[model samples]
Target: MGMIGKYARLTPGELQQILGDPALGHRLVEAMGEDEEDGRRLDVDKAWHAMSFFLDRLGFPVEVVFGEQEVAGAPDWGYGPPRYLPPAQVRVAAEGLARIDGATLTGAASRQELFEAGIYPDSIWTRDEDALAYVWAHYDSLVAFMTTAALAGDAVVTWIS
Candidate 1:
């Protein structure tokens, strides 16, 4: 299956399950290249990639979550948001989200702008307007979840499989 990016407002208990599992525990460390523990990978939703690329253009390196490994390395499971995020990181990201204008994002002008910026991958470009609109639709909720997690000083975990 193609990768799908997703995140949730994780509770501390949910985070514990992830941190307690060795496969998941050291994921953030691995992603950030803090060590060579041998188990961590990360991928955002393909749609989210465009947003990340856009952010990179603005010089804001935002790595919201990190992990492409199965949750706990389970054979048939998915990735979960790693329990990581300094309060400052969360604050910065939440503040950055204020720049998202939902109406403007889904409008024709934004589509043209994104296309011009060359941020979209073929997965989105192939479907034309529909996929683009779909990304925006989900983005609204994605930002909301991230914002909520930030407000509570919690991490927004994701399971992209």
Candidate 2:
């Protein structure tokens, strides 16, 4: 299955709605390319790229919070080479969500730790049943995919599914 298919099923319209920024949408469209012959489901590579782009432009400070052990000169997230986006960007996105929602982090964990936890560095705890349920149902899948991709040398941006 494609990446987005693994988590909460989102129609193209739903994706467009969630990705409310027009510029980001346009960027995603460009990343997806103009292949009219294929239906509009985002290609895996394009979807990954678009996700990264969306995170970078989403009006949050993605400052490079240092990882536990700064592997000297190791490419962030260890995405070996020929990557479309920065792996740090993905961590920033993930942690950014937690930060936004007042979720307390046990200090900054490496991308690996966040991956293993299957949650953002900042945890999610909410009283709103619907919102909490939605997060519980889908966040892990999203985090897992991103973590796996990063570990396997693919550029992936962290985001809520």
Candidate 3:
């Protein structure tokens, strides 16, 4: 199986509950599996690496891509424990992401540039043209996800699984 980037929107109450007991983070993410209809969840698939690299190169803060708050004791199935951003931070991230025009993101870097920059899943960078297209599509989805979370004043949890 491949690593997938996942995000879950948390209401203030849910955020508090998880913060008060870090273990709740695991339960929350696991429960998300059973509720696939929830609009609060997003899966960016394997595009996370290229997206993060592009966002970082574009001057967006790391918090927007990887989050700032680490949920201590949360299980790390692969990459690491789930990380979170508070509602205020989510709004900030959403604003930053909104400023990234499609033309700019798509034209900012070539596959070789990205590969040399050390974007993850290194093999994809030299494989085919579809790699960048795949990253761009997932990035659009991520922007939409963050925008909705920000509008709802919801916290966001992100992890690799």
Candidate 4:
């Protein structure tokens, strides 16, 4: 599988527990797999890097796309251990994401820009409109995911798989 990005909303207590025992992070990843349609989880597919570039171009901190805290000892599903954003940071990220209108998201980065930035999974970015559409759709999903996590006062755990 390619480097798909996954996000799961976690309760504050859940975050604390995971921090104390990083292996618990695996359970969250498994739970995400069990029910992808579950509101608590989001799979951004292969559009992660392009989404990151666009969001960064829109002025949101890169951490909002990746994460802040690394969960030491968490299983490396693919890229690395899961990283997370606390509830406070989630709220801030949600605010920034919410401010991004569709037009801005679509126009922030051109295909050439994405290619030049050396975004991951390079082959996909060569497809012109399809590539942009893929990234836009996933970015929209991400905005909704962060917004919901913030409203629920939950932290967000992100991992690449």
Candidate 5:
């Protein structure tokens, strides 16, 4: 409900057209991108930050490729201040994220790791069983988006609503 985001893998030129004509941008977003509409109601930025925390815990440094601020204009997608990661960069981050073991991402250990990072409140984090479910939901959702982008040689992109 607060600052939600959807992602799409798009070519630079196709993206250019979307940003160039605001009238058709919203339509394009629906058709061209994947929406995390069914997942837990977590802010995209917070989820991304948590992912960053997870990466750091493993002694790996990767770029936060989502919800960034870039100097670009949106066409039909509405206002400006959108950011996008090129296909090459998306592929790189996708690889890093994909490196996380499936079990590690959904297991108790990963939940504890995130809790230790102070990303969630102590009260809620104490409920590891519940917390882990939500955590895994977001993790899987992100992986799906990033992996899709990487496979299609498309950029990872988002715009402010």
Candidate 6:
């Protein structure tokens, strides 16, 4: 057993069970270095890799949720105002959101700016709907990746949104 594997731990019957797909299971198994008696081998890097894998399988959506004009096009989902915006809570909420593999913007702005040449939010924690507009304007690839990890068996993304 490798040192990492020995130190790592697993709580599920099999990594495949959590991933909900056989192909993902195969990938995780291959990613693992070796078996360990402690069985505690979960880590962020592995989870991130899995998220990227699943996003690749899902295929990111072409639409941007925040676009109000004809140029931005439609998306699979819509964005709206959140109930509240607190301090130090900007990182995840301000970044972006993706149900599967697309981006969404919920505030006053359209979804076009996130990927547009000069489109990015001044900050995520801003209470101004206009300032928060960027979150809706662009599809969050990172969120899509993280969501996949959270959906995976026994895995959770506690940090950021």
In model 3, residue pairs whose N, Cα or C atoms come closer than 3 Å (at least 3 residues apart or on different chains), thus clashing, are: none
Higher-lDDT candidate among 3 and 5?
A: 3
Which candidate, 1 or 4, would have the higher lDDT against the true structure?
A: 4
The residue ranges of model 3 lying beyond 4 angstroms of the native Cα positions read: 34-37
Give the range of the ten consecutive residues with the poorest summed lDDT in model 3.
29-38
Query: Per-prediction TM-score, please?
Result: 0.56, 0.27, 0.90, 0.90, 0.61, 0.21
Report clashes for each candidate as comma-separated counts: 4, 0, 0, 0, 4, 13
What is candidate 3's lDDT per residue for 110-149, written digit by digit as tens? 8898789777777788997888888878888888999999
Error of 6 at 133 (Å): 7.8
lDDT of 3: 0.82
lDDT of 1 by residue, 1-161 (tens): 56555444444564565656645544533344522122122234567655555445555545653422234443332444333444456667677765665454444434556666675464456447676666666566556656766777764444544
**TM-score between candidate 2 and the true structure:** 0.27
Per-residue lDDT of model 5, residues 7-81, tens digit only: 555666765675566444456656633544632112343354455555555655444434443525445243354
Predicted structure 4, TM vs. truth: 0.90
Q: How well does candidate 6 match the true structure in TM-score terms?
A: 0.21
Question: What lDDT does the true structure give each of the candidates?
Answer: 0.52, 0.33, 0.82, 0.82, 0.56, 0.27
TM-score of 3: 0.90
Better of 2 and 6 by lDDT: 2
Better of 1 and 2 by TM-score: 1
Candidate 6 residue spans exceeding 4 A from truth: 1-104, 110-139
TM-score attained by model 1 = 0.56
